[model samples]
Target: MTSQPTPFVIGIDGPSGSGKSSVSRAVATQLGAGYLDTGAMYRALTWWCCHTEIDLGNAAAITRAAVELPLDIGDDPSAPTVVVDGTDVAEAIRTSEVSSLVSTVATVPEVRVEMQRRQRELIEQIAARHGSCVAEGRDVTTVIAPDAQVRILLTASEEARLRRRSLEVHGATDEAAIDATRDQVVRRDRDDSTVSQFTEAADGVSVVDTSDLDFEGSVAAVMALVDAARRR
Candidate 1:
């Protein structure tokens, strides 16, 4: 009888527009591991709240929604899906409206606790199924999986980050496009910072600055860290 591979977990944290999602996905694919985009959980909850007519400002209501959020997220890096209450919201949750309000839902203490609980469960489930898993979010490294075998804080300079985000959102990196993208990347990070410390690396966390790296380079940098961790 063949034995299953031992499971491991990789946790990643980064600010908005820092390539956390893309890099983590790529790394997970290369390692043949499951991928969990924890940010998508918050965004899914925000979408659910709006869909149910729950006011974003009502903390108690939002907390209740979090507890009751019927979210089903896929762990496959190449083809991840986010479905809520039988509706595939993979794209809906990425809309500008959800982007603008996700922090509001994510900042509630009760919501974080609930989301963290779910995230931890998902990480363990994915790792157990796939032999390894990569989880990325604003607080994955610090709160969700601080003891992950490979913990990374992927970051880039503000200028680089804004340019990258502009290209992703507007398909252009001109000054005007970057300026237009600033609010989504900068303001969102600022709001989320009030609840999570992603801009800086926590103790024992490795940092990978992608200020000048392309997508492949960013993935390589993160993969290198995972390899080094595995070696230890």
Candidate 2:
């Protein structure tokens, strides 16, 4: 395979509100690379499931939806869009409906298997296109790209996460639902990362706690690590 101008990749795996998206994007900007938000890909697929009326509990149907889904990862590093089939779903995929169902759809072993496959393919393609990338998701460093050049595990307190969620989903969800959703998301993370075997980071992965740092601070922290690795 043809490699991009750079071969290095930094993977950031974290639970919600750990600020993986903001951190990864900023890290990519700092490194002059690309960024991939893996969670949005799953959410995009979940949104497609809703649009096509596929039952989340039906593994067979869901797997078929994932397989037949014409998902495209856009070429630009600035956007890195996910266009499903012919439609641009970069915005639609982040909906509360899709966010709530994303864990259920992503948890299905069949769906994870397929998405994992796509995930790896996309990483390689991104590396080919933009040289290096900082990919952020729950299972990215451990499961999707174990051999990545640099792996950063980001974590934060649930309270911080809820605060961030409140800002993001205030219009889409009520306060009670937001509270419940926060608990459910934490539960989903535990289930997928622990019970479902996506918890552990691969060897040489650095774990960072973002409980105190702001978004730019976290980006700076990861960039420091990436720069150090490049020197080695």
Candidate 3:
């Protein structure tokens, strides 16, 4: 029998619009690794709550939903999927309704506890299968995979983050779009901050600022860090 090679895990944390998701996915593809989006787990849980009519304000109820969530998330960087209870919800979880309320569900202590447990397990499985895995989210560095081979905290200025998010969601970077995108990028971060620290790089975790970097530039910056870490 052949022994499985040890996996190289990369943990990345960043606030919304910091480009962590896109950058991490690209890096995973470049390295022939699996990808995990921890935030999408929270979003899937929130969608389940809404689908089952669980009260988001009720901590106990939300926690119960988290415990019973039948979530199936894909690890492919090129074609990730999120499914719940046999239904594909990758798109539903990204809807405005889920976006507005996901923070509430994510802030529940028990929910984070449950989700983090599952996330750790998933990361291990993904890495074992693909030889490497790149996991990114608000707390992947601090909470989920602190001991990963490479850790990164991606960041961007508030103005730059807001503009990027506006362009992503509203398809424009005008003043109106920025104003509309502020709540999603800023308010969500504030609420999530209560549960996880992502704005600053923790000890031994490298920081990558994408405030001025375009998509390709951001990917290159993170890949450079990955290469340096492997060399060290």
Candidate 4:
């Protein structure tokens, strides 16, 4: 029998509004691989805690919830889903409330440890099923999948990030919209950075700046990196 090619595990890390989700999905689709939104795992856990009335400030309680989260996130990049306890929260986890408080759940060291363990398991499962998988999140490149064949840090300017987040949350980039999104996108980044080093690319990781790139351009930039990595 012919030897099967080694599976590809692409790890992407970036801050909010850095085009990580879209770019990663596009790359996964183009490469015929599975896609994992690791950040959504954290957000889903946060939403579950909030929905169950778990206090966000209690580390032990939050860590316990993370350990027991009923998460069912899909790996299909074209039609990914997030189901918790039979409730689909794909859209719910993107709400302003979840975005604002997800950092609180994500910052708990125990919660991070539990989620990282879960993420590695998910990556292994996806790669086994699909021959390859592209996983993206704040710590995907550095922590969750540091040994991935292709590791990238997607970044953009804060001003650009705020504008993109404003458009996403409020459907407008006006001053009022940007102000409304500041707390979720900007403040959350501050809180999340305390636990993950996503601001810069680690040694041996590639960097892709999407500040001036449109959607297609950003996707292409990441795709180029993946192609180069595959050639090595």
**Which pairs of residues collide in model 1?**
none
Residue 60 displacement in candidate 1 (angstroms): 0.4
Prediction 1 global C-alpha lDDT: 0.93
Tens-digit lDDT string for candidate 4 (51-132): 9999887999999999999899999999999999999999999988898889989999999999999999999999988999
Per residue, candidate 3 scores C-alpha lDDT tens digits across 66-116 of 999999999999999999999999999988899999999999989999999
Point out where model 1 deviates above 4 Å: 1-5
Candidate 2 has a TM-score of 0.88
Task: List the lowest-lDDT window of 10 residues for candidate 3.
Answer: 3-12
Q: Write the per-residue lDDT of candidate 2 for residues 1-232, one digit (tens) a residue.
A: 9953567788898788778887787778767776788888888889899999998889999999988888887635467788887898988887667776788888888888898898888888887777887788867887888889898888777776666666666644556756856754676676666424334445788978777888778878888888898998
List clashing residue pairs in candidate 2: none
Candidates, ranked, TM-score? 4, 3, 1, 2
* Candidate 3 overall lDDT versus native: 0.93
lDDT of each: 0.93, 0.78, 0.93, 0.93
> What is residue 178's positional error in candidate 3, in angstroms?
1.0
lDDT of 4: 0.93
**Cα deviation of 168 in candidate 4 (Å)?**
1.1
> TM-scores across all candidates?
0.97, 0.88, 0.97, 0.98
Q: lDDT by residue for model 1 over 106-191, one digit each (tens)?
A: 99999999999999999999999999999999789999999899999999999999998899889999989999989889999999
Q: Which residue ranges in model 4 land beyond 4 Å of their true spot?
A: none
